[model samples]
Target: MSVEGGAGEPLSDSQKREIAVWFLTNAPAGEIHYVAKDVRALLGDDAVYEAAAAEAFPEYNKAHLVSLELPDRSGDIIIATYGELDRNNYLDPRTAQVATVDHIKQTCTKLRPAADEELPSAYIEEFRSALDVELSKYVAEAYPKGVCAVYCTSGKDIEGPGADFGFAVVISAAKRSPQNFCNGSWRSIWTMDFNYELQFVDIKGKIQVDAHYFEEGNVQLDTNIDCKDSTIMQSPDDCAVSITNIIRHHESEYLSSLEESYLNLSDATFKDLRRKLPVTRTLFPWHNTLAFSLTRDLAKELALGK
Candidate 1:
């Protein structure tokens, strides 16, 4: 609550507000606790940890910086930094340098090398090109009017074994300009949204993966590849090609259902707001509405009555 212990002065009102906004925008919605360095990176301010951690004590590893109670009253956000503890559960390894090394040691697995050591950068680019060609063809045949974009990734960070093979396809279509239909000036819209993300990870002796047709929410899958030759690291091209084929097959099978869902959302959900528009169905001059009176009385008459 109060700054002390030479960390620095208390955070200004602007500083507190910035910290809260930065945390909400950048940090994951499901997580509240964050380390000081993570806060520094997310906020893009190097001095945050010291100023915010001024209130922290040596006995506690977690240095509470910003405390915010949610508007919905579900819970609060306690933005803090947790110092690394040793095997005896003591906060001996408190510096950022030690924490960085510990993180590397934990996440850099044998099968998944560091980002720099993974397959050549050129190979990753090639993999991306292959995915784009194949996915673009599928999108063209499936949704002729829809705009498709592909993002390919093939690297591991200090967090986990990044996906050996991974890509995301985003399809956006059904543009609508509802300047007049909606209540306010922000009535412009584009209703259709469909995204597909696929990733494969090699764990132990098995290739953990699973296949699904279509899902409304985020979906993660796992499958077991028992064949030793299927390891992606050993045969990158063959594995990539095999994954692309699998994606094409799944997209072909379930894309129609996804389209149907989008159609239903547009027809049933969008129709409600569409019908409520002015009979002209044209852009309403909402800015001019302030000139009219709701009580159906002259201004003088209303004043006299009041």
Candidate 2:
């Protein structure tokens, strides 16, 4: 089996054998195994100690750095012994940043109003701070596992007179491991973005929003919402909860329609993508071919007197 590792002293024959034995004893199924990452979770603390003692590669402590690959239908299982540190020195803790009121205010300061703009920066900053706090609270409580961003303004927009408060909330996070062609290793990734915006205008006020939801590449939705009401300025808490609910409702609708869309794609689009047989194609006799080969082998063995 082929063995690969990061830059360091090459693994000795004894070390390679130790890694292989560790895999055989722990990961019998030959699954994608991360020694440092999974041993504690799947096997226990003792397994972690055992793995550390066996492999003895202390340079990279993270589990993603060390892995063993065992694929089905294989002659010699490929034993990936160790991994390398990121050349770019990238690090990810996989935790969402909790946005505080001070954090939001700092973000607002940099968004200076344009020249000849009459919009009051202080008023907008105050409004954004209030809304940001409420929204941050809602996100922290409702989606503990999700990340949130409050969209603020410098108080100068074509929406006319009143300010606009918007935010983006992303939930149901997952890890992505895309193959890194340069090193032939997988890279971990996560991302956040807004897809579309909806705006509403009226005599009282206006609310503009951008919403998006993504899950397992099954469904994606983009929609606009133009809501006009004075409640946005009247009660920041209520507006924060209301906007969150609106986004949630749209996300629910998008997910609910996923099954129907998948079925339609399977029935129509999948058929067009599938390969079709030629009109003149016919089935061949597979039983005769196998029998003839077996008979020839048997005859040869008999002729050899074995």
Candidate 3:
């Protein structure tokens, strides 16, 4: 976590309000989002508290320093933990902030015992469910420009370990001008080329798998920032700058949602996966490939060009 606070020292009441106001600005309103800077104009500066919260939280978990829901709201939607500090006659603001921050950090922000990339963090022992690291790639597949910019975070451009967002750039390129996401096939695909773990919790909270990869494929967490196919932006630098501005304005569970979903998987599910991926061993002796089809009729979709 890049942000830090004096965990042992108590904060003044003024500091706490500043932090709360800071959070209020970034809080989501339905589908509309807020930029911290714009909100800060009205709320004043308190990123320090957020930084402290980040300090209190673990690495990777720092992104979720502000996960609170007002009331009667949870799941992937409205996120605010404490009630209006005004209405609650119980805990003082600092006390409430402490309790809420502490509770959230403990419940959420689990680390994915990642021994290595190429495999989903869930594959590691003592691992709990985590979003596919390549979720940015999937977001890119869906939103291309908008959502991908918010979530995708990889490549030489990002200065971190996130191929998902980097791949979102690739997705944007294709989306901005579909003539090529660099030629369409997996051959042109650089991000999310691996057959990593996949699962989703349903309304009843059952874990279900859509696919898993073949054991013999090469999963590269490419961070070179080589794929620039978007007509939407100028360069990788522009991609990062542009998209980060978008994120400051909006948010998706890019953080705590995974924390909320973290759960230990039964040993049995690992024993029985319904599908295998990267069934393209013919292309490269290394291409252990196969896999998804949700759109259109199965037949017509299957009939599209390879």
lDDT (C-alpha, whole model) for all candidates: 0.30, 0.29, 0.25
RMSD in Å for all candidates:
20.9, 22.2, 23.0
Least lDDT summed over 10 consecutive residues: which range in candidate 2?
75-84
Q: What's the ranking of the predictions by TM-score, best on top?
A: 2, 1, 3
- For residues 22-85, write the lDDT of model 2, one tens digit per residue: 6534421112234434543433345434544444332221222222111221111111111111
Model 1 is weakest, by summed lDDT over 10 consecutive residues, at 182-191
Candidate 3 local accuracy as lDDT?
0.25
Off by over 4 Å in 1: 1-120, 156-166, 177-245, 252-255, 258-306
User: Per-residue lDDT for 10 in model 1?
Assistant: 67
lDDT per residue as tens, model 1, 185-214? 000011111111223333211111122211
Q: Is 1 or 3 the stronger prediction by TM-score?
A: 1
TM-score for each prediction?
0.26, 0.30, 0.19
- The local lDDT score (0 to 100) that residue 108 gets in candidate 1 is 11
